[model samples]
Target: MELIERIRLHAARSPDSTALEWPGGTIGYAGLAAEIERLAAELRGRGISTLAISLGNGPAWAMLDLAALHAGLCLVPLPPFFSEGQMRHALKLSGAQALVTDQAVVLRERLDLPEPMGSWRVAGRPLSWIDLPGDPQAVPAGVRKLTFTSGTTGEPKGVMLGWNHMEPVVRSLADAAGVTPSDRHLVLTPLSVLLENIAGIYTALWSGATAIVPGCPEVGLIGSSRLDTAAMTLALDRFRATSAIFSPQTLQGLVEAIESGLPRPAAFRFGAVGGAPVPPRLLERAAALELPVYEGYGLSECASVVCLNTPGHNRPGSTGRPLPHVRLRIAADGEVLIAGPGFTGYLGEEPPAGEWWASGDIGRLDPDGFLHLEGRRRNVFITTFGRNLAPEWVEGELTLEPAIAQAALFGEGRPWNTAVVVPAPGADATAVAAAIARSNLNLPDYAQVSRWIAAEGPFTPANGQLTGTGRVRRAAVQGHYQQQIERLYQ
Candidate 1:
């Protein structure tokens, strides 16, 4: 069944059941369905063929997204973490005719947008609607969602997907996570993220589960890199969240908070960690704290989730088995291959000719069928001595140290590796050096960092050194610290 149809069915079957919850309010299934219907009708009446939205995690964002999906208007979700240039590129690439955003001030200042075309209020939050001046660009047929990829270059690529691509993933996630009306899923990340949008929100709606979607600030998310785990834990406890998702960075913060004596929320039943490789040590720490986090793997091309670890079957170091809907294989060269129904191709790009999509990720299925990822195929670097290593492999080990927060390894055809290290808060230079020594003990001499320099600050999207999803932009990072890195080599 279509997600919207399932939502309507839930409304018909259980009108009074809560479907969405926020800081100051709660909406029942019937109320949510009615609101989506009303907004969808208004959008259709306005002759809107394409819609874009930039809002925080809240009922307003949720309703706008559902309404666009129900009205069959193509939806473009502009991520808040995107720079103005990337945002403009997405708007132009998708040819969004209208944009509704809560952060109108940012848009006005950044994009030089004209006066608002009108105002809209949904679920008690007021929003501004701006009519953009672009014709609808041609996209592949059945493209309903235009999601931008966090490309290494400054410009992000637009990934086009249809309902057929999204719904199966939603159902797979719902079944994998065992989502039910009793599960109060917490929105820990931005709603614009495909992971959170499809796996978190859409899956929650499909299963008739209540979603607690507070603004980013309420969930302790600040900008792209900073997280207040204490505040996040409080929110989880306050909402009694039964499920949520996190990037590895956020999960690290939560684990540290628990170790610092913050009471762990006992209501959590399912917590998924993804977007980048989860350091196995971090998972071990979380498990030691009784935190129920499952490691998963996916890409935007797969419509968010391809494989996920669940309570029923999980491996701490491996991304769980592939979901029932998708087939996974390891090529002879070790690239992960995915064959699924949902991928429509990129905007203004040719459709994939092959039955399988090369994920660009190198991985292998263990004897138990769990997927174990190494790193990006193109990111593998060879040392001057002919030793090949993936930076992520070394970086992951470095970050396992409590004193080191982020590490970017760079050593292509160089005698030794050098890293730009961002120290954890309150960690001193001596402490960081000691942590590096400890990390180096775990790595081979070829991949070990021989010298390192302190970074100016934590890599972030604003600084163009980190992707919105929290993965470091390696090329950008290396370029930004070129002189310092050269000094280390000398």
Candidate 2:
């Protein structure tokens, strides 16, 4: 319970249903529980406590994130692709005493923040308020959602969590994706991360459904690693979206716009891809274009789904099985641990020293329990003839070759493996060297690659080489291709 008592139990059992949708209106569930108890009573009459929500995906950023969990305050969520020194190191390491933005003169001329300590109009937009001088700190008594960590491979830590560790992972992801109220979901990413704010608006308002939220250019999300796919397939056919959530590069541009003919949304049912590592030939070309997608797995220290692949229980390359309140294990050097009830520690660090949660991700599980993963134990590497590999398993088999739109790999001690690629758009260089010789004939021979080059661009998140949840910030793409990876190792 308590996602503000499940939005006042869906405003006492569906008060006029709808519960949020955007491009200018639709609020219901008793006007989203009276605009989250009137902006959590105008943020507990301005004493605020910790707030921070930098706004973007509409409906007043889901009514001030459930009115900062109904005004017990503490929120944080900034991430509009961070970087103004990670939003002034997350408003001075989360000491944030009040921010609630909507750009506000580009965060008051880039983080000088201060001025207006008042302004609001809630769901009809506007917003403002600054305050922020500091001296708040002390957050760790069931800290209610601090978030942060999408810094790809650098600074962005925070984590925290609470609401009894994120309402049992949003009631085990609405009972492993069977979420109903006829699931209209569709806020494809950025409700300030935490996997689209607890698996896309707390599992679409814990199954009373209808989330939608718009803006990120009405779902084509232009910035952090571009995406348009015909304005995200006309915002999933103008919100006929029956469930959404993606990031395996926007489910590889909506499975290459449903293999070029574009037109998947016949009330789309369940999408859910994950933040990274999803290439079983892009889930076999999104199941040969039937495009139901699936593929899940998480981290934000487990509060955002801890394994999923739903819809008649999927498994096309694992990362499913484990959501019934999560518990998965594996260690014995294969890492991926995770013991249940959603993790609850990490703002200034210290708290997780055991009872599983090691998850520096490297996976296994199987024997019908699914899971799989296999990468990021500090991204493996080690070659100089000793072998070892796992550059996301050779860049997920060189992006399952639709003329490889990205690949990174590099051999940590050298002796064979190179890559940089990027292609896919009139591809060439003989179709990216024949898709790296058909991805080195299915890798091995010390994780193959041998030599490659092509990428003088496209590894995005505005060029820090990806990671506003698109992953590959591999030391900023090996320091922006250190002289074409030292001329492919001379």
Candidate 3:
């Protein structure tokens, strides 16, 4: 069944059950259904077919998203972290006919867009509608949603997905995570990202659970990459969240807070960590702190999660077995390929000419059927001595040491591997050097870090060295530290 039908069923079956929770408010299932229907009617009245939603996480955002589906309008979600250029590119590329946003004036000033066509109130917030120019971009038939991937540089590409591509994944995720009506799923990541949108909120709603939707600041997100741990703890405690989706860096911060004596939420049942490669030690630390963290693997092209580790069926180092709906196979060259109903196609791009989507991640399926990912195929670097190394493999080992906070290995065509190390606070050069030495002991000689230089500071989105999701932008880092890396080689 469709997501809209599920919402209606929840309303009919349990009218008084809370469907969504935000700061200072809660909307029950009946009330949520009413609001969705009301807004959907308003959207249809306005003849909104291709609508763009550019708002922060809240009840209105949730309402409009579902309302669009009910209204039979093609929806495009705009990530708040996107640059003005990216926003413009997305608006034009997706051919959004109208935009619904809370900060219309701000966005207009930032993007130099025209004045709003009009305004309307939904869920008690005044939202403006800006009419876009030209005909809407032609998308493949059956495309109901257009979600853009968060790229490291340049404008992100839009991935078109329909109900057929999304609903099954949501159902499979709810099953794999054991989501039930008792689960209070917290929305920590932005709902614009397909990961949080599908696996977090959509799955929770499908399971008839309460979804706690709060603004990013309320959940400890200061900007794109930085997180405020105290705020996060407070939000988790406030909502009594049973499940949440987190990026690896955010999980690390939460783990550190718990280790430093912050109260861990006893009600927290499951935490899905993904969006980047997670170090196995981090998972071990989280387990030690009594935090149930399950690492997963996914891509925007695949409509979010392809494989996930869950409580009863988890391998610490492997991204768990593929979900029931998807088929996983390892290519002869070691690329992870997914064969499933997911991934309709990319907007303005030809569909890949194959039954399987090459995930571009190099991985191996263990005898137990768990998928163990090494690194991105494009991220593998060959040393001057003919030794091939995946930098993430080495970096993952380096970060296992307590003193080494971050490591960016760069040695393509160089004699030996070296890194720019970001040391943990109060760590001295000797300590960082010792940590590198300890990490090298665990790695093969060819992949070991032979030399290193201390990073002047942390890799963050503000510095353009990290993506919004907190993955290191290796090209940016390489360019920023070219002198240091060259000096190490010399």
Instruction: List the global CA lDDT of all models.
Output: 0.89, 0.81, 0.86
The deviation in Å at residue 241 for candidate 3 is: 0.9
Compared to the true structure, candidate 2 yields what TM-score?
Answer: 0.35
Candidate 2 overall lDDT versus native: 0.81
Best by TM-score: 1
Candidate 2 — number of clashing residue pairs?
A: 1
**Model 2 poorest 10 in a row by lDDT:** 133-142
TM-scores across all candidates?
0.98, 0.35, 0.94
Ranking by TM-score: 1, 3, 2
| Candidate 3 per-residue C-alpha lDDT over 1-490 given as tens digits, one digit per residue, 9 for 90 to 100 | 9887898899899998999988888998889888888888988898656888899888888889988887877889988777777788888888888888999989989988789977788777788888887355455556778998766654578898888889888999999999999999999988888899889889988989999998999999876766798889767877899999988777887888888888998799999999988988889999998899999998888888999999999999999999988999999989999999867777888887788989889999999899999998888888989987888878888877879878899989988888999998899999999999998898888898888989999887556676666667888888999998888877
Candidate 2: the clashing residue pairs are 162-165
Instruction: List candidate 3 segments past 4 Å from native.
Output: 400-405, 423-435, 454-458, 461-464
Who is ahead in TM-score, 2 or 3? 3
> How well does candidate 3 match the true structure, expressed as C-alpha RMSD?
2.0
Q: What is candidate 1's lDDT per residue for 1-490, written digit by digit as tens?
A: 7777999899999999999999889999999999999999999997867788998889999999999888888899998888888888888888788899988987999998878877889889889999987666555446788899886665898888899999999989999999998999999999999999998899999999998899999999987678888999888888999999999988988898889998899898899999987889889999999999999999998899999999989988999999999999999999999998758888888888988999999989999899999988888888999987889888989998999999999999999999999999999999999999999898888988889999999988888998888788999999999998887767
